[model samples]
Structure formats: C-alpha cells, structure tokens
Target: MKGILCTLLLLLWMITGCSNNSASNMENNKKLAEAVKQETEMPLEMPTDFNFMVSFGYGDVTKNVIDTYEGTVTKDLIIKGSATAEILFTADELRDIYDKMKTIDIMGPKELSKKGNCFQTPSNEDLWKVTVGGETKTFSWTDQKCGITEDANQLRELRNYIQHMVEGLEAYKTLPEAEGGYD
Candidate 1:
C-alpha cells in the first residue's frame, strides 16, 4: 500500500511539472499578452479611408489568435493600435521591420494545413495587409509541421526568419505616443 501511494504521488508530481508547457498554458500566455497589448496601445486618428491603410496580425483561427507582439508599420512609423491608443515605434526599428518584411515570402500556400498532432500547436498564422494605389493586399502563412501537407516544408526558411524577426522586435518596444489634449 505504501509503495503504491508513493508511485501515485510521483506520477502526480511529474504531471504538474510538465503542465508549465501544456497547451492550456500556451493559450493563457497568448491571452495575457493580448490583454497587455490592449491596455498599452496609443490613440491616433486614422485616415478617412479604410480603403488605404495597413495592418498585420494572426490569421483565421477558430479562436482569436494572439501574438506576443503584432502591429503595423508605415513609411515613418510603427503603430500598435488598440481601443485606447497606439504604441509608437521609432523609424529605425520600423525600418528594420520593413527590411525584414521584404525578405519574407509573404505569398503563403494556397490553403492552410489542418491541425498537426494532438499535442502540436500550429505556428502563428501570420498575416499582413498593405495598401498600394487604394488597394489592399493581405498575405498570410502558417507552419504546421504535422507532415500532412507539403507546405510544412514550403517557405520554411522564410517562416523561420519571420518568427525570429518578431521575437527580436519585442526588445525594441519604444514610446507609447498618445493623442495630445493641449488646450
């Protein structure tokens, strides 16, 4: 009886320890990161035309996909839009983002792959929209290493590069420029 009880406790401890990286924890982290982003974004009057603007975020998920860092970059600025305001970024950082953007094969596969293993989580369904001549083009991609589809290998190199670019940009979060209330 004593040995059985000890083995049960050991199994419970192992399960608890592994839960730190469990899928539930991943979802929680994404939710918390999105909440923080919403609280800190800055406010700016958008151009009158939705016909010509820029935006970027995760693609279609059954649930809203949350990224640790996601936003849009224009010629002179990076704007993280939220209900409250926009968190502003500098020209240098935005410039780097744009440069990296140039290298990414944004033209993703014609269709996304189905989910991978039961334990597998798909990579960020990255999407970006840029407007040129009043027309907006949205590009999207995701990595599902389940081997169920050929796209798991296609654009693999660019996907890796883009993942690193987003993670690196986290360190460069600059000013949170809010709208002026000058009387």
Candidate 2:
C-alpha cells in the first residue's frame, strides 16, 4: 500500500511540474511574439526635408498644381481663370505621404519601363516631382487613357490619389470654380 501511494504521489508531482513548465513556455512565447511585433511595427523614420509637387491637367496652360515647397495651389483654367490658394500640410499628413511613397518605391526608379511609348495631341499631363532624403525624382506622363507607359500609369494613380486628397481639403473647396472650360 505504501509503495502504491508513493508512486501515485510521484506521478502527481510530475504532472504538476509539466503543467507549470507548459505555462512558462506559453508566457515566453507570448513575450517573443510581442517583441517581434514591436520591432516590426515601429514607425518609419521620416525624412526631414520632403517636398512634393504635382501639376496635373491639360498641359501647363490649363492645369492645377499642388506644391508643398511653395505651400500654394495654383488652379488654372484653359486660358484666363487662374487662381492661387495658400495651403499647408500637417506633419501627420506629410508622414502619410511618405508612407505612400515608400509603398510605391518612388525613390527607387525614374521609370519602371525601358521601352514604352505614349501619344496624344494636347493630351492631359501629370508631372510629379518628389524630393526625399535630399534626392529628387521627377516623373512626367500623359493621360492613362492615351496608353502611357507602366511607370506613367503608376504616376497617374499617385497623382489621382493626391488630387483626391486635395479636393477633400477645405482649401481646395474654398477655391472659386474654374471660370472656363477646355475645348
């Protein structure tokens, strides 16, 4: 009877020890996961002097431009109705732009395609100039509907994104309606 009780007590002790070890292991695993998440999810270090300029519409004569360095938006009509508005972007907004630029590898290449042709007469144009980390890249392309290069299409998307963002801002909304229409 004593032998049986001793064996049962040893088994119980072993089981308890194993459960404690399992709980410790689980805690360690959780800590490791949290540490990895903290390391990976850390916010990116934004550049100190970042500037972006996007001029879009029917060439330069009938275009609207949002220039961060100039802190101005120039809204142009075909010939006569041109207006300039003061604008400012908050730090958070700039950070968001930086994040988006990084996502699209804007600083990596001037053009993603080597051989692509686009053609349109008096076609709308999108000109993007971005400066990051003291390096500048300028991209110019025509309307996507005119069958532009792949890189130009990417720029179009970027331009559209910025235009949409600007349109939602109070400054853009306050601007007077464009006076004339392009023929």
Candidate with the greatest TM-score versus the true structure: 2
Per-residue lDDT for 148-171 in model 2, tens only? 667777777877887777778888
How close to the true structure is residue 108 of candidate 1, measured as C-alpha lDDT?
A: 23
Candidate 2 positional error at 92, Å: 1.9
Backbone clashes for every candidate come to 7, 0
Off by over 4 Å in 1: 1-85, 105-123, 132-135, 144-183
Give per-residue lDDT, candidate 1, residue 8.
100
**Candidate 2 deviant stretches above 4 angstroms:** 1-43, 60-62, 112-118
Q: TM-score of predicted model 1?
A: 0.30
Tens-digit per-residue lDDT, 114-143, candidate 1: 565533353344444543223345655554
lDDT scores in order: 0.41, 0.75
Residue 124 lDDT (model 2): 74
Q: What pairs collide in candidate 2?
A: none
